[model samples]
Target chain A: MDTAAQPDTAPAENLSAKVYADLKMKLIVGQLRPAETLSIRTLAEEYGVSAMPVREALRQLASEDSLIGAAKKAYRVPDLTPSEAANLFFIRAILEGAAAEIAAENVRAKDIKFLEKLVQDMDTAWQNQDAVQFLLVNFKFHSRIYSLTGNSALQSMIESLYARTGPWLAHGITELVTIDSWMGDHPAIIGALRNRDAALARKLVEEDARWGVDLYRARS
Target chain B: MDTAAQPDTAPAENLSAKVYADLKMKLIVGQLRPAETLSIRTLAEEYGVSAMPVREALRQLASEDSLIGAAKKAYRVPDLTPSEAANLFFIRAILEGAAAEIAAENVRAKDIKFLEKLVQDMDTAWQNQDAVQFLLVNFKFHSRIYSLTGNSALQSMIESLYARTGPWLAHGITELVTIDSWMGDHPAIIGALRNRDAALARKLVEEDARWGVDLYRARS
Candidate 1:
């Protein structure tokens, strides 16, 4: 008799998942800021799709801590507290330092060549003020080193951590008109790897990462 | 008129999610073996729910790589390929080893006491042949150490890795029955913490993990 009161009616199929993906990419690329509220309907109309996929994508992003979901509230991008930021940097230092060490120990000649080429690509992109291409090449360069560690899980965990920091790092890249000195660090890191000096490689990566974090914080 | 051929006319809000959670816990506890598959309808009936939750749960589990899913096909538990296992252990060694170091520096006297008591609880459960309780306490004990690290991201990554190996570890625990030796390792780890020797603490944790991995592999 009370079947009409059922609250678990099935949800409609989502059509806005594409919007969600695009929005997520934008968020990761610093096109959106922390605490930004992405209105579902606005996105749906803009993407020319219904709101369902957007809602689903938002749910998944919330699980990744990229978005915050609260009771009776629309989702918003997560804000990093000072303490969380400090802790994130600590975790990154350990994992990335270890990654650099492993990569140097196992870096093949081919991998080093790829990294050098990628760094060159970064310089070209920097001159062109092509933020998107610069960001893409930067990701590939770091990832090539990580994958050389030959530890898929470590590679994955590092990637996840980096993805969470994408917005900050992307912003840093965009504001820097010419990253000549920053680009200089890449070759030094690669040179250390080529010399098979694991410790030196690790140090360079940690220094590079620390410098990036500091620069981003100061800019913010 | 041709929309009938489209997949997912709408998102299904079903009870399969609850089924998935229940099954996942059992799988983590070693009730399910690698390559095992259960009929969806059968599991639904056994869990006293409709098939929807089971479907949703399987999809979620598949995303975690704990279960393998194919569209309109039966889901199967993923086998722990040797390389995958090795990769998981490697990441765990790094993260948990660092956690022990952090825990040693940060854990309170009361936390040490709490850990010691949990070790005793492990002894009691092992004596009573209560495999379930033994597993539960062991998980809690390690989790307590992670909490002491105070890095939520590190803790979360470590737990996901733990879950991936849950079934295998449970089987190892049941057959190996070297509970005393395993429980014995915790005190040495705690002792290092008590002394605030972070390096020593990290070393002990790494040794403790290596021992477990060795045991698990021997059984295999």
Candidate 2:
């Protein structure tokens, strides 16, 4: 499913899918701001592709509720209210916590080592105050563990959740809290995973994911 | 979001949206078969619409992973492997359990009465051995409680999970087990809610949701 390694196909179709994937990632990583309007012409120009594919991708994401669209109008990233934001993190806490519990059951020494490296890198990104890099690396850190669960559907659902939070997190961290505060829970989570304590891992991950609600509250 | 009451739009769009909504409901209620390939021509004829709108709806559902699609081919419902099916139910256990806990906090006397009515209706459906009606009413029974949480995102996530399970469940209940086994847990769940015992509600709901895995196993 990595577009880079996939075989070639019709140019237009590929461009639309590529744009969709790229935009989904950007939305997940907070590359775009919440409530920001996305003009097809602007995105096409930005990606150096035609407007048609950008439009298609926007429609697709809108259907997923990650964006707001209307007939012949530009798409806008959905802006969550404080309560809506809290509800989202609440659901994430349950889903991702369950994911962590499953991941702990499947953890291996090498997997722990890999997670450790990502944690260290996340710390480095935090120390350097590279919010965007920190966000992307933080994504990889969690994705590694979710992948261990061997449930693509769970991983996909979790990923779609980021599309709603990414913009808010990307913006909230800059003004409300340091990246380290959010990163603080990662080490303990890794420890629980290393010990193969599924219950503890679930608890810690739930604790870690609860920061999203706090972030939303602080911003409000 | 209810399509029936909305003012009509362009005929093409109305048809497409109606098809999409209808298909989504059918999938949720186990009216479709897992891994069953759906022909656009046949569906268009079934719905008495043009193939173009049917094709568009199929593409939309396929994007959502309720159906699988390839260019110039019919879309097939995803047939999950046993492990994959178990994982789906595992995630649901967490999500729905969380929903029930929250619903307990928000439950009113009238809400309990409403839920009791649903439980009775589900029992009636079981007495009639109406697998399809049982599935549909069970959806409403769970949905009534989940709606109490006022978390649209959680409800949406739970609903999407149904799309993946419905076809299999519909098939399984008809052949593997009767509807009563699954209905056994509902009354206790209602009691937990009536008592406003959040923890008990969560535990009971988790226990109920875990039935999906058992259902899948019996068939396998």
Candidate 3:
């Protein structure tokens, strides 16, 4: 989903999307917290744009559940508990699974090679204890597969899920275990894609979601 | 999805959700076409409200893909072709299937009894050649199952899909065949949920999506 906030023909849209992407990355990187409010005035001044586009970006983020919008109040980041994150991840898994099923049906050798490179990079990032690098690469891996589906609505839904649950995904991921345990499904996904095993690909994508649930349960 | 726009604690939120729901029904019933632009001013005037809530409603619709937003232009109903609708339906089927799987695990006797009554009503609607009645009941039947999932994110995702493809669902539905042919899966779904067969429920839900694809392919 990191297509670099490609601009639409409209300048307003470009600005809105730019603001949305900036806010999204901040959410993903744990720069924003649920307690803080995102003021249209502040964001407008910061982006050096009118309040209109900033307002639009806030509305879009609120729609995505990335930001909580209260009546007559500024939007804020949504504070998601682990269980809540698990529930969100449940939808994400089903969607990513469906996306993988589509990808498996249409994947090419180059796609497989690209995915393999990501898996390697992700493993390297994990080994280096770089959660940020690992997650960035991890998102790219999933994003590539989602892109292969060519469903913008579905893609946006997954991206929203990613953005909405960004902090949850970033939180304590490295605490769970080494890269082998967390990144275990990447190899299987590659194998399933290579074999064009839609069901296997789907199952594997879904299977990967269990870690978050188990992580929550294990602590409980 | 058609549960009368539930009012929130915030008056502004209630008004926005109200406007969103009204516009959603219009989209579902095909009162609005893709050619007509949805101006915030016109909608605000129609609803006798200020421009802010109307603007929020339009942006929400645009986010759900029920409306198309171009840069510096009013939002318009997205013109979806059968093929495009089919693609969207593919994702819908997957998410709905996941929802059904959850429902199968939690569905109760009373829920089954209620669904049975709806099925009977749906059959009667089909027998009377009432597309509107049939669709309303059909949506209710699915909504009940989705509600049992207790997953609002999943519920909203499915709702967005339904809204986004409302026109497609309304187009040429009865043209395909008799009620028995189209509504054949309702009984099987009931059985699967009653038996708590999560896998069967999921499969049946997914299978139901094939009809739309088949109908489109047959027409092509």
Candidate No. with top DockQ: 3
Error of 3 at A160 (Å): 1.6
- Give lDDT tens digits, candidate 3, residues A93-193: 88998899999999999999999999999888878877667666777788899889988888888877877766665665645663356677888999999
Query: On residues A58-154, what C-alpha lDDT tens digit does candidate 1 reach at each position?
Result: 6545544667766457778666775665677677778888889988889889998999999999889878887656666776787789888888667
lDDT of 2 by residue, B1-220 (tens): 2222112222333566678777877887887888888999988888888886677677667767788886656799988777777877877888899899999999999987887898888788878887778888888888888989999888877887877788878877888754347766888998999889999999999998889888767655
| Candidate 1 docking classification | acceptable
TM-score order of candidates, top first? 2, 3, 1
Q: Indicate the worst ten consecutive residues by lDDT in candidate 2 chain B.
A: B1-10
lDDT string, candidate 3, B1-220, tens digits:
2332222212344677778777776666444655568888977887888998888778778866789888778788887886688888898798889899889999999999999999999899878877666666777788899989888788777877776766565565645663256678989999999999999999998888666676666655
Candidate number achieving the greatest TM-score relative to the actual structure: 2
Question: What tens-digit string does per-residue lDDT give for candidate 2 at A95-160?
Answer: 888889889999999988888898888888878877777777777778888889998888878877
Off by over 4 Å in 3: A1-12, A34-36, A127-129, A174-180, A217-220, B1-14, B34-36, B127-130, B174-180
Ordering by lDDT: 2, 3, 1
List per-model TM-scores for chain B.
Answer: 0.79, 0.88, 0.85
lDDT string for model 1 (B58-95, tens) is 55455456676665578887677666776677777788
Candidate 1 deviant stretches above 4 angstroms: A1-27, A39-56, A172-181, B1-28, B38-58, B177-180
